[model samples]
Target: METLKLKKLSFSARLFTRAVAALSVMIFMAACGNKGGDSAPPNTLLGITNCATCATSIPSATAIDVFSAKNATGLAQFANMQLIVSATMFTPGASSAYNLYTGPVAVQGQFIAGTTLVDPAATYGYGNSCTIPAGTYVMQSSTVGQMSLGMLQLPELISTTGVVIRMRVDQGMLYKDATTQQTRMYGSVYITSVNGVPCSSSFSDVFN
Candidate 1:
């Protein structure tokens, strides 16, 4: 009789252990499902540029698309997320290769210029600007003049019909000089659509 009782107890314990294990697995699966569902929210498609590989942070006024995203809970998640800048220009054709930045001009702000002070032993030039147009532009490099080693493309300027224009600088890349061997500097420009479209006017006037 004692033997039978011991056998029954052992069986019950084994069954209880199996049940606990099953329950644990179910809980784990539920947690995993919740985690998988929680992905970074989708962001609006913005222009991509290579960041200036320098010490200074690109100013915010040069940013293009500036917006925030929220989760289903209505909580703000990513704010002012900028586009990733590419190190090299986007080559569509063989002759389409262009420098990312040219000598800067006063598009919205002051007329900043591109610099040629690069680190020796590097092959590319550095010092880019953080200004771009709203429309898409083809990247090109200028073979003439002082500004000769960055990306260049003219964008179609539009009128900002009473909307707040925001800028966000994200990334940059710097080239090194072949002789001096110093790291060059680069910056990005992200232009985004405002209330209607971005114009050459001030942000306040854009909303007016």
Candidate 2:
């Protein structure tokens, strides 16, 4: 089975499971207003590789290669969504294909909610990982049961948005901050428009 990974996300979940109370308090703080802290700063992810042929270990310190790119113009409305990542979150290894780790370790990225898309040629270069649009959906996730099905399991994204799209990824490590210990995630994800139309085939992105 292909690994259905979300490097930073799964680790966040694992951390929460291990320290439910403390994590819960942190979540509460986040909900209340403390957006950034030493543990996990706001909007940071370090996308490095695509989870293909790589060492099975994470490095100690690394810079974030935040994913960025312009949205495909298939759907004109696609340009109004957001795509924000800390440009710091990442994990070490990722499978070129799906290969569940049975634990934390997956490729991931997030689309911001407010960032609008632009003609790559008009402003930034045409293919930089800096213009992924914020989609009109909820989130991207998979259940253990669905992971067994194939490289991807988007029962939720499909059921909610009624469409699917191709995705891209890169593996790397995330540096929360100098004071906080860094956790690795297969950071970097690029999404495609479904049939050149907004919502024609779409998938919600997790907050990177």
Candidate 3:
């Protein structure tokens, strides 16, 4: 008889799970606050919460590089698939490869959506030699709204309109504002496109 092996979770995935656990604790604490006080629910991973208004400024590094060292191997998976991440409700910038969103995004969309197609090799100007494969990959997420395998529609995703994009669920992290204690999700995804084109892809964003 052949034995089946179970894959161990990646380091990033472990961290993501820990972050979610922390968020759950925060939510419970927020709910138990004094009734007379203005107790707003702590932000969940599902969506934004006054992100634009948050006092913390966006980091200078790309979203993928913001939290920790950039995961080159993880990044390659997204590129091989010709997918890019987008900032929530905002258009990706055209000057760079991967065009990962770095700003706060509003509700709706993948917290970001890719609006164009750039060469997969140009991501971060690393001269990636990976080729874009056929088929679709949905943006990877563990949130309730993102759990479904259905095709997500975002008119802004010109190249990836009909295609599905995949992102590593472990690459994402939940960000909590030190001042406001509000939490948000920031993670990586694949991207390919610049200035808009016909090829399909999806982009991931790192929200602060």
**Highest-TM-score candidate:** 3
Residues 135-195, candidate 2, lDDT per residue (tens digit)?
5432222211122201122221111242343343322212222223222122333343432
By TM-score: ranked, best first: 3, 2, 1
Cα RMSD, model 3? 16.0
- Scanning candidate 3 in windows of ten residues, the lowest lDDT window is 146-155
Clashes per candidate, residues 3 or more apart or on different chains: 42, 41, 23
How many backbone clashes are present in model 3? 23
TM-score of each: 0.16, 0.26, 0.27
Superposed on all Cα atoms, the candidates' RMSDs to the truth, in angstroms, are 26.8, 17.1, 16.0
Q: Which segments of candidate 2 are over 4 A away from where they belong?
A: 1-110, 118-137, 142-166, 180-186, 194-208
Tell me the lDDT of candidate 2. Answer: 0.27
Per-residue accuracy of model 3 over 1-208 as CA lDDT, tens digit each: 1101112333367656755664554345344542332213223322222233222332221122111112222222222111212334234332121122333211222312222323432453444322333333323222212111111212122222344432333244333333443333434333433323222232322222
- lDDT tens string, model 1, 163-194? 23333222222222222322222222333333
> How does each model score on lDDT?
0.24, 0.27, 0.29
